[model samples]
Target: MAFGIMMLFVAILCAIAVIREVKERNFLAVGFAGISFLVFGWFSVMTIFVSGAPEM
Candidate 1:
């Protein structure tokens, strides 16, 4: 539960940064922040519910 909450908080921060960059008309920053959001969200979900490793 705590991890989930932290993920949400991070996502919100990323969203805020993206919005700020968009308003400033900085395309590079916007793209970077957007990518950051995707990566952070993806890793957060993947790490939390990961499956067991396969046998060698």
Candidate 2:
């Protein structure tokens, strides 16, 4: 659960980076960040679904 949360955070950061890179017209960076966002987002969601969320 903790790992999932951490990955979720990382995915959010990558998403922000993707947007910024797109605005700057850095195709390479955009590609990297976009892929990172997709991979990390998927992993995080799946992990959370499998393991369940942490207690508040």
Candidate 3:
């Protein structure tokens, strides 16, 4: 649960960075934003499907 929230925040930050990079025309920052978005998305999916507690 916490991880998902963290990832969501990260995704928002990355999205902002991506927009900034586009405005500044920085390829590196754009690439980083893309990677961050991918990672954030993966974590979001994991958080949704993975159980938070041990199965009983």
What TM-score would every model get versus the actual structure?
0.65, 0.91, 0.75
- Per-model CA lDDT versus the true structure: 0.77, 0.96, 0.84
Candidate 3, TM-score vs. the true structure? 0.75
Given candidate 1, what's the lDDT at residue 21? 93
What TM-score should be assigned to candidate 1? Answer: 0.65
Candidate 2 lDDT, 1-56, residue by residue in tens? 89999999999999999999999999999999999999999999999998995657
* lDDT of candidate 3 over 5-53, digit per residue (tens): 7888888888898999999999998998989988897887688568465
Off by over 4 Å in 1: 1-5, 51-56
Q: List the residue pairs that clash in candidate 2.
A: none
Question: How far off is residue 34 in model 3, in Å?
Answer: 1.0
What are the C-alpha RMSDs, in order, of all predicted structures? 4.7, 3.4, 2.7
Error of 2 at 33 (Å): 0.3
Residue-wise lDDT of candidate 1 within 1-56, one digit each (tens)?
Answer: 45755775787788899999999999999998898888778766665555333546
Q: Looking at model 2, report the run of 10 residues with the lowest lDDT sum.
A: 47-56
Candidates 1 and 2, the one with greater lDDT: 2
Per model, state how many residue pairs clash.
Answer: 0, 0, 0
Candidate 3: C-alpha lDDT: 0.84
